[model samples]
Target: MPSVRVVSLVPSLTEAVAVTAPGTLVGATDWCTHPADLDAVRVGGTKNPDVPAIVALAPDLVIANEEENRAPDIAALRAAGVDVLVTEVRGLDQAFRELERVLDACGAERRPGWLVAAEAAWRNLGAPSAGATRHAGRLRAAVPIWRRPWMVLGRDTFAGDLLARLGVDNAYAGHAERYPRVPVEELRAAGLDLVVLPDEPYRFTRDDGPEAFPETLPAALVSGRHLTWYGPSLAEAPEVLGAALRAVYR
Candidate 1:
């Protein structure tokens, strides 16, 4: 069979396909930062990808995510006669399944070792339960994705799901919007046990994020890659993120 050429619009999927089958990617979005030395042609950002430029690459397929990529770009690619594979990952189970499907679509020779390790790591984690840590019971937290208008992980988000599995339940998981803008005052008064701060889409840091919350509220500064991404990073996320949360709990 002929080799498959792929362009990944999602950063996580870019790393996924790149690690699974190197050289298969001829084009990727500017945000596809993993694999550090990826040689794919940059087709702009995920939200505003250059459709004509992508078409010019003539990839056999383009992989995208429902949440990370815009629909019009996918539609435009299809209209340009490109075969685009769009994936949606709302939960851990679905993430694994989608990873397998994506690798298959990319014609990976076999399931990548990292993927196997990631699956085993999460599977062995068992279900989310109250930890025996100092702050007993499942830690309820508010995950802030952005500030200056203050957007947060609301209902049905991949990051929120991952947090839940780590025994950190999102405070806004039942909100109507997947990402809702809430007042900082309201967040402070939300009866949260902790505030989880990730380092992307906002780049929350020691000085930037922690200052927003009351001195009494515990703030767990974690990697946005682990919290928001669903690629090779998933393998070590539990350990990395767990340690961060544990530090706050202690």
Candidate 2:
């Protein structure tokens, strides 16, 4: 087989590829920040990657995510004969399984240690205590990704599934769209016990986001990476998310 040369379009996948097989990544998206010192060509953002620039890198494989990237770009690259590896991860287990697939395609001789550690960390975690949920029933939370038009996590999302594992239920998990846009007033009136905010897609800070929520509902600002990304972050996702969610209990 030809020696693999990779270009990662997704930030999380970039971390995965770089850390698993260092020196193999020749190109990555501008948003890819892990490894901090990653040596690769910048391929623009996830949604608007420079296809011509990517083609010039002569990467044997270009890795992308179904949700983070646009279909037109993936088609354009494939039309140019680039072997595009498009992965879809909707939960923690899928994240690990998909990582292995991507790594194996890139010539991994064995499973990387971080992958093992990440799985163990999630497996060993227990759900939040009953009090943390506060609701005698399952914890109900509104998880927002954007604020301008106001979008919230709805159905079949990695973030939603991750929260469920911690015993925190998503208020809009049954909505048809994976990310549904609802007005702020609607969210507040949705009978939500709390609102979980993540800092990505839009950087929802402690000052900026929590204030938007109605005082009747509580809010917790969590790391966007831990809530969204599916690479090495998976190792501590359970703990990081657990701590943040538990804080809202009291």
Candidate 3:
């Protein structure tokens, strides 16, 4: 195994890679704040990494994500003859595989212990039986991702998928885009059971404008990254999110 210095371009991968191999991380983006000490690094955010600064870091490997990083930045890094590992994880299984790849890259052997723990945590959460008892009627929901045009988590998206796992059906499940916009009147007419306001991409809070949704729809502000972003952190989310769903549905 070779000793390799690494730069992380995506915030989530930055956090994951740092945990996987701490000392090997030479540069990380501004948004990668899980470890907190990562604030010392020069950053240009996830989509825009400083190429010259990255080159000056002289890292042996650069880790990035296909969804979070821009194609041009990856191309520039590759053209510079720098070794780059790009990950594309749409779900939990893909996330675990990505973590394994990072561990292998960092000269660390994959630990079955970690996988078993994660799997057990997921299985221990069980399924959402509360929905059957408490939610006999239509389970209407509004998962707002952004304001203005009012985008929401649609079918096949990570957030939508989590809602299904919790037995809370997405009201916008039929929308074409992963996140789609809905009119204010449509939200009112939908007769929602709950409206989930996420903390990111929109930053909806209790004091925020969600009150406009007619008092019938109960709203809860949740961690957007936890519900939407799948990675090593996902292994921990089922327990936390399951609790949230049980609280809301039950």
| Per-model TM values vs. the true structure | 0.96, 0.95, 0.86
Clashing pairs in 2: none
Positional deviation of residue 101's Cα in model 1 after best superposition, in angstroms? 0.8
Give candidate 3 misplaced runs (Cα > 4 Å): 112-115, 129-133, 136-140
Model 1 clashes, total count: 0
Candidate 3: deviation at residue 181, Å? 2.7
Once all C-alphas are superposed, what RMSD does model 2 give against the true structure? 1.8
Looking at candidate 3, what is the lDDT of residue 46?
86
Candidate 2 — which residues are off by over 4 angstroms? 130-136
lDDT of 3 by residue, 1-250 (tens): 2387888886666666666565777888877766677633665788888988898888888888877799899999988888899987665566777777876775655544445576566656555643664656545677888878887877666577676666677888887877777887888888777787878867888787467688756776677667865445666777666666556544
Q: How does each model score on lDDT?
A: 0.89, 0.87, 0.72
C-alpha-based local distance difference test score of model 2: 0.87
| Model 2: per-residue Cα lDDT over 1-250, one tens digit each | 2388999998998888788888888999889999899999999999999999999999999999999999999999999999999999888788888999988887763478888998888788765653345755678889999988999999999999888888888989999999999999998788877799999989999888889877777788888999999888889888898888778765
Winner by TM-score: 1
**Tens digit of lDDT per residue, candidate 1, span 1-250?**
3399999999998898888788999999898899899999999999999999999999999999888889999999999999999999998888988999999999994478998999898878854543447546788889999999899999998999888888988999999999999999999999988899999989999999899889999999999999888889999989898888888756
How many residue pairs clash in each candidate at the backbone level? 0, 0, 0
Q: How well does candidate 1 score on lDDT at residue 237?
A: 89
Q: TM-score of model 2 relative to the true fold? A: 0.95
Q: Which TM-score value belongs to model 1?
A: 0.96
- The alpha-carbon lDDT assigned to residue 212 of candidate 1 equals 85
